[model samples]
Target: MTIEQEKFSGGVAVITGAGAGIGSGIARRAGEVGMTVVVTDISAERAEQVAEEIRGAGGKADAMTVDVSKPAELDRLANEVFEKYGSVRLLVNNAGIETIGYAWEIPVERWEATLNINIHGVIHGVRAFVPHMIKAGQEAWVANLASIGSFGIMPVQTAYMVTKHAVQSFSECLYLEMELAKLPIHVSSIIPGQVKTSIFDADAGKDEPTSTARHRQIMHDIMKAGGMDLAAASQVILEQVAQNKFWVSTQPEMTEALIEGRIAFLRDQAPPSLHESARQLLEA
Candidate 1:
């Protein structure tokens, strides 16, 4: 069924990580569409900044500080938003952290932090918001941010890759469950290739070994050069979501080839070279 754009007007949209990058881009688009945008972030200042910007541009907006990794905070956010707005029409679980290192070489704390924010954060959002959305009986949607890494392998990024893969799987299951229950809520897995974001600069301020620093530098350079514009990518994502489409891919052609290569490998062909795939993506 085709979803009309008017459905978003006057709707309540809560977006995690709305302080910067892709999240901020999505928040701006939501505001432009006349949605009451709730810009939530771990950084209170940044969240407030985004909320104010939206209001300045003639949209309804609010700011809230929420650490999505914490279930209590997310639950409280849900309660407060529902109390004020009465219902939520969109939930964007976009908060995530990146840990760059081989699976075994990464510190335990880093791995835990990555999983808590990237995977469990989305889980907590679903747990806290789905019930309320159901009770409200409003047409709603959840957009979970995964990555191209969800379907492809990248060396020294095991932690980020693992969590993104989990998000993809979780989103798929959520879609099926909602369909089976005949719920009005829709779910989407936002599988983006690189978008211009500071996520790659995460390791810049860290005191890491020479090799780790070098690796991060290489990644940072590649992404900076090739990543899609944050605004453009966000627009593509929300457009697909408005249509209730799943598999929200930013770079569809590249993503399709990666998935096809994975299938080919599973069919007993020569394993696709991860480095080759990454090189092509970086060049693209």
Candidate 2:
């Protein structure tokens, strides 16, 4: 019933990680408004399933597989969507991963893998697609997935926080830069608190992971403890989007943490303990 809800009708959207969870939820919601959707995921079958679901619901839909960290794959996916629909007015970069461990105990591969998928994936999508959106000369949207972790470090999930910080910074810069260029394309970033999605299983080793994986036993336990329904969270997010809200967030709890952390960072001197932790992790 919001203005944004009224406005999204008849648009064509490209959503990453659209096979399930938040991505599927966004794609389906986009469908409800009669938008042509291109569902993309690393799993081709799952992506196709999401697209088919939209089609089944009497909406325009298509599907593709993309490893978002790879520029070539992202470029191809963009071209395919544009070739069929003429424009990709909305882009949701929602693919990500997380691994949990004590800073010193974390595996370098796990850290790198998290960055590759969680951070660079968004980079690749932006690089391969956003310029074309700028040239399209329409009121477009770019939504990047971030997390509350970017506000402060979660004890065992250092890499996830780091990557989210990168994503948050990138999305913010993009939003400001686009505005400076007088573009109508809107930019938003979602920093979900604890949506009930398989995102918690991001580092679950080697399983198909329809939401059931965690790198660390304790972290997995913490995640398995549970959160809000993915559908419900997605709905909240969409409502925010309809308002041109850039920080589409579900958790009101972390606001203070965000405020305090920045204030402390601004007022404090570098602590030696911080360097020790970094050195221990890097020199291992």
Candidate 3:
């Protein structure tokens, strides 16, 4: 059955990276339907703040500090959720980081950190949560955040792009595995182009973007020109979850680009034709 047709009554969801951005939006949407939400993030206070907002709005929610890269943290978060909510039917692996640099300029440390959070974060989240979720034998769902970067041969994203592509393929494989196991679990990957979020602050620091740099300004412009808002994307995600769609995508305008990109990869031809703004984006 479709995610919506299956209904979310009595289900529980635990979302990582819920302090803000797409993760928070997803939590809010799930709460709107009266589901129990465990809002988790590396930032403990922010996660709690979001949880408080949910409760203030008459939704059941709990906040926990969870670093997706840490298995112990994820395990503790899941334990707390099950202890309180009794069951968990959803895991949103949304904690991610992007380390962008020219292939030569990229630091191994930074690249690994990105993978620790982006790829391994998803890995740890699933490893720590899914076994328990399955052992509980409940109908559940897993949503891993990928990106359109997975499709683009866009330059400079390097490790970030590689990790996202891995996420996309990993999610698909998990979905099929669940089906083969005859388990009542659903898996999906989201490949959004650029949602209105604070992701540009990836290196938000005393140095990198320096916190006061033009990071936000650039991200804002990107979202305005090349991205969609979080709310709009969240609606599609909820709809997708309800439908158990394997791929949740947006910006119909980019549909053709993604299609052609995939076709090129399969035929061992050139990467898909670039978007009109590809040059400008690549230079960015």
Candidate 4:
């Protein structure tokens, strides 16, 4: 048997934003590996659909509606999961929205949503669940979704970039905390370079500035053309998580390049400059 099966089989996995995209892929993979999967999303219908797919495949799964933007909801979710499952083997804080536009141009509500969902969501997920994990005294895994945007600066994508940076830092500190406490929990920062998803779809960007339609379309096309396969990326991520690695990246080369650029920018104290492709996309 594979390492993932050895570590995770017959355990319970709670994943946020499992209705679609990478979250859905990971939930499916968890089920495939013989875990009982709890698939959660803001949309009840979508969450149930994904859970049903897993059940149909002869895997165990359940669906729940969870809005990660609300800390209370996360608390309730943790309470319920622990009460029902006895213990959680894995928890993935993966619900996030992409906001595209100039920082000043984005609406207050959208900015709050982005920050609350992307940053606070991950924070509260840990806050609500770690105590249970500690009390259970079982080896558990927590994976927070970071991105390539975590390392670099972006003009129009400032809101999204800010949250990613925060998440990366949070994950780093969380890993250290686990080590300091000598807990049986493993923390992983999942840095995905580009995997196929609907983050930039027109409907997903309805809260952004109307003028950003072109930029959103451009990014959507780019993802469609060059993004990694969702299932393949999920498999890589889980394999690394089972190994208890802190840095779980879908594309290590891209992560390395971004980190290098970030280092140079910091070392030289360079002003932020837009890449030519970003310039073209914004100008188009």
lDDT values, one for every candidate: 0.86, 0.77, 0.77, 0.94
Runs in model 4 deviating more than 4 A are none
Candidate 2 deviant stretches above 4 angstroms:
102-109, 206-218, 221-226, 261-284
Local distance difference test, candidate 2? 0.77
lDDT of 1 at 156: 68
The alpha-carbon lDDT assigned to residue 104 of candidate 1 equals 69
In candidate 2, what are the lDDT values of residues 1-284, reduced to their tens digit?
65545767778888898898889988988887777888899999989998998899998888888888677998898887767777777899998876665656556776667888899889888888887786777788889999877766554566678899899999999999988988887888898877766755544544222222233444445555766677777777777776788988877576456647656766785441333553464344
Superposed Cα deviation of residue 80, candidate 1 (Å): 0.8
What's the count of clashing pairs in each model shown? 0, 2, 3, 0
What's the lDDT for residue 219 in model 1?
Answer: 81
Residue 57, model 3: Cα distance from true site in angstroms: 1.2
Instruction: State the weakest 10-residue window (summed lDDT) of model 2.
Output: 207-216
Which residue pairs in candidate 4 collide? none
| Whole-model alpha-carbon lDDT for candidate 3 | 0.77
Residue-wise C-alpha lDDT for candidate 3, range 150-267, written one tens digit per residue: 7666555566778988888889888899889898988988777778777765444222323223433455467767668787888788778778788788664564577676777778
Candidates 3 and 4, the one with greater TM-score: 4
- TM-score against truth, every candidate: 0.92, 0.84, 0.88, 0.98
As a whole number from 0 to 100, the lDDT of residue 212 in candidate 4 is 64
- Stretches of model 1 off by over 4 angstroms after superposition: 1-4, 202-210, 269-272, 277-284
- TM-score, cand. 4 vs. native: 0.98
Q: What shift in Å separates residue 6 of candidate 1 from its native position after superposition? A: 1.7
The TM-score of predicted model 3 comes to 0.88
Q: How many clashing pairs in candidate 2?
A: 2
Model 4, position 118, has a per-residue lDDT of 99
Evaluated at residue 147, the lDDT of candidate 1 is: 87
